[model samples]
Target: MQPSLLTSNASHRQYRGPITTAIFDWAGTVLDFGCIAPVEAFRQVFSDAGVPITIAEARAPMGAAKREHIALILKEADVQARWQAHTGHASNEADVDALYKEFLRVDEINVAKYADLIPGALDTIAHLRARGIAVGSTTGYPREVMKNLIPLAAERNYKPDFVSTVSDVARGRPFPDMILANALALATPDVRGAVVVDDSPTGLLAGLASGMWAVGIAASGNEVGLSLAEWTALSPAEQQAHLTPARAKLERTGAHFVIDTIADLPAVIDAIEALLAAGERP
Candidate 1:
């Protein structure tokens, strides 16, 4: 006998409870002001290859698995033309491998340097915990890169209850595996009762794919492209100039809410609870 369709729907239940988990992306979303480490590493690798890329090009595929990130850059039309001109051939897996090796080397050294918790990240997590939310994290970095980072971040009071890295999943963001891993580790009741907070469109896409609320961090992260101190030093007009495009990009990518930094997260969580109370999902 065949199984009933109801059996499939049985495990597809939605939660009516208030949000129970807040899964965050690590670098830009929680630590490393302005998401500098990986972007710098990316720039270094490409420049060393004699095919330098602008910071914008380096950041264009932020939040993907490192190899996938390299692949995406290689696929860019201008980058592809440059690579062919430089190497006399189109980029391939070997080129990706070479770039990734350089990236890993540069990133391992720099990741610890940038491990300082973004201002207000610790307090925000504490506030979330006080509200009974379990905090989990996902990172584009593999476990090896995170080995130093996890401990460094914890020492700085920015630890999450659980962390899932690219090594822990078959695929990284724009795929839901990392966030699902967080939900499983946190024992979240349903995807509907969770939030995914990140600083990249790929991360937001992961949340949307997981049927969870997607919160984008704008000015304090990749989009604004400034260190915390640099951002603070900007005049109000300059700040607005950075924020307008960043916020628009996040909204365009389907973030349910966008805030400048983690410091603003607690209030957003409060608003999300109210929406949940109104029977909204995601």
Candidate 2:
């Protein structure tokens, strides 16, 4: 389903260092600290539908396209049971489509309110740009949401060189389409020369499946699942306890590296370049 990290006959071929582009997932990776907007909207949609799914259920399918995300959430056993009990029938495709429409309306309305850039997001992008590394972005958000969100971010001087949305591609998270689209649009010298910085395991898998290095974001992203204020309110030990499993979860996704947030990304980029210099593949 994806290009191999290495060509069969090119085992001797080596990648050079200093990387080219860094692709980012939008919500938690760069802005909206805990990826709150979508989850809130998801919950609202379900509640409006009389199912009233929990936050965990809403967040469970966070990295897929909104419609696909709605489909995944509806596929949850408990959600299905609740749906049946509430409506006296199994949820069908029409329910999915209707809920997705509501999700779009709700999320698009709320996304701008959560568009604040994650701490160090702008700094990290600046640092990468200074070193001639192009910064690109991919997201599960559709164009309607981006229409509101992008200007908000740009108004704050945080804009990626390229932005690819779920609607821009045939498939979204856990699939390589969005990530590869970023690399291809950037004209990256090689796939391995690009990095994917994501907060979700699904996004990291997409990056790896695209043959790009992946850096998982733990604390500032979904794995920690806390708002910036809520996160900062925690004592050091509290945060540490959360990050342990967060790191492990992303690590299990086969990410080449994992760090707290985008602020910690530049150093990881340098580390990945060292691997590239040694002819290592992500």
Candidate 3:
């Protein structure tokens, strides 16, 4: 079912409190260095369907609901044309279903492998919690995948107070449902005072749509598309090649702030609090 949209009037209300909640995306924003699990799953699923997609193409729809991600790619003109050329027919819901099934199967097995917490993620969440901010999470992964991820992440000392998955909401990122769900779970009274941190355009848009401050993490995510080690190995000039475009895209999508990684988040939070003090509202 589609979630009821928050009325425009509701979104415009001013709130006077400090930020009480910080909702984050899972893979790219906090764990799974390089955000490689889903990307690899996308590649494998499409290639298995005889329609291979480039990494850029696979990453294009990152942060959407899994099935919707597949559908979005199919809707792309180039991807559609390629699908027809490969299969001798137009792609349809059936094709999406097949691809999504394969993706889920592949991802279920591989997600845990990439579940290592991104450096600074645990510390950042702990810092936020220590400041009396409630830590919550939203993710593109469904319940089944999260069933594995949640425990793994907790074992490594990186657990949020609440987790809202795609299955927990009617719609996923680019929509506000998941973020709103987090607010509901965190028992936050005002959405505007919460912060949403993510690494994808859709996730940023979701935060903006929810009238929350949106911070985009650039390097440690899909946009930069490099593992921590891989990113560190790149020459400064080479790294700029990735950071420039990724930061631009996130900004274009209305991210309030685009920083390098979650390690910089505390300062960003301080900046946000300062803005709130000055009567700013997201």
The best candidate by TM-score is 2
TM-score of each: 0.93, 0.95, 0.92
Q: For model 1, where is the 10-residue window of minimal lDDT? A: 8-17
User: What shift in Å separates residue 54 of candidate 3 from its native position after superposition?
Assistant: 0.6
- For residues 1-282, what per-residue lDDT tens digits would candidate 2 score against the true structure? 545645664765667766999999988999999888898999999998899988889888778888988888989999999999999998889999999899889988778788889989888899999999998999999988898889999998998888999999888889999888888888998888999999999999999899999899999888778999999999999999999999999999998899998999989988989888877888
Quality of model 3 by C-alpha lDDT: 0.89
Off by over 4 Å in 1: 1-14
Q: Flag regions of model 2 displaced more than 4 Å.
A: 1-12
lDDT of 3 at 81: 98
Query: What lDDT tens digits, residue by residue, belong to model 3 across residues 1-282?
Result: 435545545545657668899999998889887899999989899988888889989998899998999999898899999999998998888988888888889998788788888888878888898899999999999998899889988899887989999998888888999999889888997887899999999999999999899999999999998988899999999999999999999999988999988988999999998888777888
In model 3, pairs of residues that clash are: none
**Which residue pairs come into collision in candidate 1?**
none
| Per-residue lDDT value at 168 in model 2 | 91
Candidate 3 residue 271 C-alpha distance from true site, Å: 0.6
On TM-score, the stronger of 2 and 3 is 2
What lDDT score is found at residue 35 in candidate 1? Answer: 95
